[model samples]
Target chain A: MLEVKDLRAGFEGSEIIKGISLSIKAGEVHAIMGPNGSGKSTLAKVLAGHPSYEVTGGEVIYNGENLLEIEPEQRALKGIFMGFQYPVEIPGVNNAEFLRMAYNARQINEGKEELDPLDFDDILTEKMKMLSMEKKYRERNLNDGFSGGEKKKNEILQMAILQPKLAVLDETDSGLDIDALRVVSDGVNKIKSADNALILITHYQRLLEYIQPDYVHVLSQGIIVKSGEKDLALELEAQGYDWLTPTN
Target chain B: MTTTLVDASDQAESALLNLHKKFMSGNRPPEALVPLNEAAIQRFELLKFPHRKHEMYTFVNTKELVSTVFNLPGETVVSKDFIKSHVYPECESSYLVVVDGILNEDLSDNSAIQSSINLVPLKDAVDQPEIKEYLADTIEKENDVFSAINTAFISQGTLIDVAAKKQVEAPLQILHVSTGSASGNVTSHPRILVRLGELAEFKMIVKYVGVQGNYFVNSVMDILVGEQAGVTFSQVQEDATDAWHYSKTRVQQGRNSRVKAVNAFFGNKITRHHFEAHLKDVGAELLLNSVSILNDAEQVHHFVRIHHEAPHTNSTQNFKNIVNDKSRSSVDGTVIVNQGAQQIFSDQLINNLMLSDNAHADNKPNLMIFADDVKCTHGATVGQLDENQLFYLKTRGLSEKVAKELLTKSFAESIVQTIDFPGVVDYLENTLLKKLEA
Candidate 1:
């Protein structure tokens, strides 16, 4: 389970997400929808312990641990994953190698046995098959020269391999096509179990039709103003954020 | 073996005294010491040992290195098993051993050498009339001090010749090993001369390794490519860190010829390398690449010059350095194009990844041109790892140290990935991993 107590985070000196709070129980998917500059991505980044975004206030408690106090890598070892809106292009670094390292990082952190090269290949191949990723992606540099859809699917593939306790998807559906979206969504659904929680951050409600969130929350001006069941996502999709603003 | 810093007063001064006297009092220098033995010595007399004030020698001062002496080297013998264990582990290779700056004839391969290929040591190459003529005629006599010193006090080296249109199936491994003691501060000159005939293709791997001792090595190499010849050379410097090494490599490419070079520098207290490539004919192509990792108080400087003389030529040069501790590095590269060299496409980029705050890297990419119809660009960047990439990697479950190492390795992979040999590529990767972990 994950509980955020009045989280306030932002860049340099100014606060972007001010006094925001939320809670998500295990085995459930939570959707956070907001307009542009509403600080949805900021919240996800803060939870992932990005150094650029300073957490001036608030506490992020995840599975009984203060996530904010640890470094980004430590947070990652504790089962926190972020699927970026735009994946980085690390040329000359093989995708297979990076994925293996990521998997081993968590294994080592949990005091579990790590996988060797042969076993790593076997498991990674199975995971890649499920994601429908081309075998060539294994040898190519991470996200280097990759298309929008490939980058998105690769992100999903990483999430599948890490099998983290909590995953924060940050606009993962932005540049993906319908085929890529369906594949990524299916991969995410396959990994959802009783031991982990999913935080879906998106502006459009299209991805919700596949993952099916347990609760829908509307964020604006760095604050959560509304929360309800799945029906709220549909309502917001139909009416937009116009009605939420105060009138004269 | 560790090289302790002796005070400038007693032991250190005596070491310097012994090295200098032994150098000047030695018997008449060998004939192979220079392209023009007497003429080159005069040039050496005019130039002085390098000082820190020299822009190219800023990080590594040759004066401090040459002031000490080394034991004269003896016995140019290397066991076959040692070569197998150290240089080529994956496959069988034809080897050339140059011990103490002199060619070890018994250890070298002659029967396996191709019919079109002529392999001779400097002891014999100097006797050939044509060799003497071209050795000094192709390039200018040394204006720099260290080069003149190498010319004036040199002993021997290696000469490789590949006939026109001949291609060697196996890679050539050139091993320059240092052994023996000549007494107070020792010095030796090693030279490599390679000539590729028209339409020939070959790859050479040169290793400059030390036998155990605090020695100083000074070497110069001359390489020439004939019309349409293609060559790729890789230099791996894992010499003794306690020694001072100063080296130079000069190359010239003929019509339609192509050359690709890469240097892997991983050693020494003070090491300096200079590379110059002249594209003197039409349609010539050259690619220069290098990667160096320096730690402790070590300093490494690499200077390169690429001159384009004809139209329709292509040239690209890139050098990367990873410095830690208080080590320092510098890269100066120049790409010149003449007026007649229209349609020349050239690009030079020098990038450095500094691992510590005190470590420093100075990179300068210079360009001078007399032609307007050419594509030329040069840039340099020095900084730490990318923060975004670091964060993204760490968020994937890697520890901060692991993530940083991966990124740094990736930065170097840009150049190493271009190596055509898969085994060599993997070997370099593992070596870099160890360095990063350290």
Candidate 2:
């Protein structure tokens, strides 16, 4: 469903994702683990079409279309979802209203009828219930004054609502407690389907315990150093990224 | 030749004072208001139109207003449909329509609230003790030229008195409509006096609307809240593009009294509002919020002062401005805590969103605290929309324009939501969106 050929992207003039290649088919889950400043989050942002990052040399084809040419909003409508590592707090926009707007945007993209507030409330309630989110989530401002765990849960809740074909979860497990991690993992698992794919970006193998990954890729200094089955996560957790580092 | 030029210039600068003289000469004011009018005229004479160097008028340019000769507007006939179009449906039966600065009894209908409150025209109620005592008591006409001018010509105004401990269920609406004359530019002074007795509760919405032609609306409102009384006052200024609007509102709160004043400015070429709140007793609380959505060459300036004269008083002032095109907005707010007013809590914040490089916003938040152990804070921000916020919304599938509009509206929503009047929030939201889209 997605292919990245020699993806090299960076911010300003420095290269971060250097000559990386990856391909993911439908119904597959991939975990990319790396240490600090290892370009784990940069890859996710580049795929999401963040404007601050410039793609120097790369080609990303999603569903046989040049994904790089699409704008951020168009990318979302085209079924590319990026779970922000740090979701911004918009103090005045209501959470339920924002969710409805996103859902309706996708609906309109697919030539479907738009759901009004009352009609969309049912879908929101169901998705939130599945994610174990409280009713206050429906009324509070979008991520304003929300705890770190609540922000992660909100991202998963968005995933459940939008039902994107491919979701890039960046650092979703970084700030979550054990219980919040379990709940967030359960939400992702519940939404997983045979026609969609997932890319989990994390630094710890603890998240792999909750949601098993089909493939594990170790990233170091802007390049992929190792690719193996899920057991590679446990190996790295026992040791560290030092052995995987490439010597000059 | 130099003497002649100076004389001509001086004559031209005295255009407003000449207009004032013409008004007083042609009309005879009430007997009870003669001394007050005389005092106000003297004050206006001493302090004429404020110059650019004036402290309060630093950012405002009054060259055009000082040069233009505005005639006093006479009573004009207006259609019922016109009045009905501007009246809020919720206040249809309790609204007072003021046309050309005079209360239009035929067009106004206060039958629903006549029993709970005493509503009398200023000229007719001048003999009443409350009217005589509180008419110009709270406002400092000596220091403000506009307030002095408004007081000098306060023949057509309203005096509303609420009985002690009475709760006014219906929200009162004071609709000031300016219908400029075809002959020349006109000006009107609309005065409003509201006196709430002890423990009384009342809500009022004052709106300014103007029709075609060039006009000026100089308005003044003095609100006196007795001990433990609560009042909610909302003002919406939607004058014509060619109109000039100025207002001075003075509020005095007694012990444990509360006042919430919400103001929204959407129209007028040049608009200025002078707002002052005096917390005269302990436990008094004041919440002042204002939002200005300006475009084109429109200019709006707000000068606000909150006085914490008694201990334990609290106040908050939030001013937001959304300026686009070449428009400009300024907010000069100050909170003063007296020496003996200890333990007072005061906060002032000003936020400006500039959508164009040419747009200008001047914000100054000042605090003068003479007491010890008081919590006071002031801050000001002037910037464009947040790019991170924009990207976040855009990634959620909203187009850039929709995202910007939503964010701009959200900036004003915090203040608009505090208004409790029916259909007001919707009106303000729609108006703000329309202005943003334009």
Candidate 3:
């Protein structure tokens, strides 16, 4: 479902994702893990069309469309979702109102009828229950004063609503407690299907325990140095990245 | 001494001269208002008209606006349909319609209002000494050109007096409509005086609307909140594109009195508003909130001053402006804490959002503290919408326009949400949404 070829990206003339390539099929979950400053988060942002990063070389293809050529909003409309490491705080925009707009935008893109606030409330209630979010979360400002766990759960709730073809989870488990991590991973695990793919980017193998991945790739210095099965994560967790460093 | 009227616009000179000549010719001058008119005209002749060089009129040019020769407005011929269509539909309240500067009793309905609240035309109550006192007391006669002009020509107005310890259930709606004269440009001077007795609670809405034409409107409002009284006053200005308007609201609060004021300016060619509040005794509170949404080449200016005379007083001022096209808006606010006014808390915040390169906003906040123990802070911000917030909305599949519209709506929503009237809130929300979409 996703193909990346020699993707080279960076910010302001400094190369971050230096010459990397990866391909993943449908129904597959890929976990990209590495130590700090290893370009793990940069790769996720590059694929999600973050305007800050200038793709100096290579391309990304998704569902036969050149995803790199599209805008971030177009990428989203075409079933691509990015769960940020730090969700922004929009003080005045209501969370439910924002979710409805996103849902309706996608509906319009797919040539389907839009749902009004009353109609969308039921769907939102079911999703909130799945993530154990309180009703107050919907009425509050979008991530304005939400706790660390609430923000992460809200992101996953959006993922469930968008039902994107490819989901990029960037440090989704960084600030979450044990129970929140399980809830988030459980939400992601339930959404996984035969036609969708997810890329889990994390520094610890803690999240892998809840939502196991089919492939684990060790990334260092902007390049995927090794690719292996789930056992590779256990190995990296036991021994730090010093043993896996490529040493140029 | 022959007043020189130095550095004045030709139009302002002409307008003042015409009005003076008419007044001197004994054109139905009331016996009680002759001295007041004479004094105001003398002050007008002395001060002339304020220009850009004047400190208070720095960013606005009053020369061109005062130069236009507006026909002296008289009784207007308005249809019932016009009056009905223009009334605010959101809230069902008693309406007092002032047409072309005259209080139209036939058009005003006060049957629904509580009996404890008194609504009467100033002209009818001019015989009472208290009516004369309010008219002469609230506004400053010296150094204020517009208020003097309004006083010099005050013919019709409304006087609302609330009974002591009485709470009015429904809001009082004062609708001021200016319909251009048959011949040419017309000007209207409307006045309002609201007095709430001790422990009285009331809410009032003042709406200024005009038809499309060359018209000038000068309005003055005097509000007095008694001891332990609470009043919420909301004003909306939606004038014609060619209309020029100047309004001043002066408030005096007694011990422990509270006042909440909100003003929204959405239309006008040239609009200027002045708000002054004096906290006379301890524990008085004031909240002054305003929003200006300007587009095209329109201009709006707001000048506010709050005086804390007694200790333990609190005041808050929040103002926002959204400018598009080549429009310009400015706000100048000053909070003064007297020497004995210790333990006072004051905060002022001004935020401006510029949608285009040509749009401009000038914000000035001043704090004068004579007491060392007072807590006062003021800050102003000017910029476009947050790029990250916009991008986040876009990533949620919203178009750029929708994203910006939502963000702009959010900025204004912070103030509009404080309005408890649902109909007024909905109307303001839709109005702001339309402006954002445009």
Question: DockQ for all models, in order?
Answer: 0.62, 0.64, 0.55
- Residue B131, candidate 3: C-alpha displacement in angstroms: 7.4
Model 3 — TM-score against the truth?
0.88
lDDT of 1 by residue, B94-212 (tens): 66777767777676663445564787776678787867776665324565666666655555556888889999766677777766343445567787889888999988777787766
* Runs off by more than 4 Å, candidate 3: A32-40, A91-94, A139-141, A144-149, A174-182, A203-209, A215-246, B1-14, B17-35, B42-46, B120-142, B281-283, B310-312, B340-344, B373-377
**Candidate models: Cα lDDT each:** 0.79, 0.87, 0.84
Residue lDDT tens for model 1, A102-210: 8988888789998987899998999999999999999999999999989989998999999888999999989888888899899999999988999999999999999
Best by DockQ: 2
- TM-score-wise, the better of 2 and 3 is 2
Q: What tens digits encode model 3's per-residue C-alpha lDDT throughout B1-438?
A: 123334347456776778766745645555566666767777777776885588878777786777677767655677777777656664354878888677787887766784868876666656778766655654334566887888787765667889799998887788898987546788778888888999999988888887556788998898989999999978988888788989999898999999999888885688999888899999999998888888899888998889999999999999989999999899888999999999999999999999899998998899999999999999999999988777777777888888888899888777777675666677788785478777
Model no. 3, DockQ: 0.55
User: Among these predicted structures, which one has the highest TM-score?
Assistant: 2
Candidate 2 structure quality by residue, lDDT tens digits, B1-438: 768645654775477667667777777677766766777877777876675578888777776776677888876788899888888777889999998778888999988898999987777777877666665553343577888888888766788889889999999899999998777789889888898999999999999998675898999898989999999989999998888998989898999999998889985678999998889999999999898999999999998889999999999888999999999999988899999999999999999999999999998789998999899999999998888889988888888888887888778786787788857888887775578878
Runs in model 2 lying further than 4 Å from the true structure: A12-20, A57-59, A134-136, A139-141, A145-147, A174-180, A203-206, A225-227, A232-248, B1-9, B12-14, B123-141
lDDT per residue for candidate 2 within A134-201, as digits (tens), equals 99999988898899999989999988988989999999998999999999999999888899999999
- Docking class for candidate 2: medium
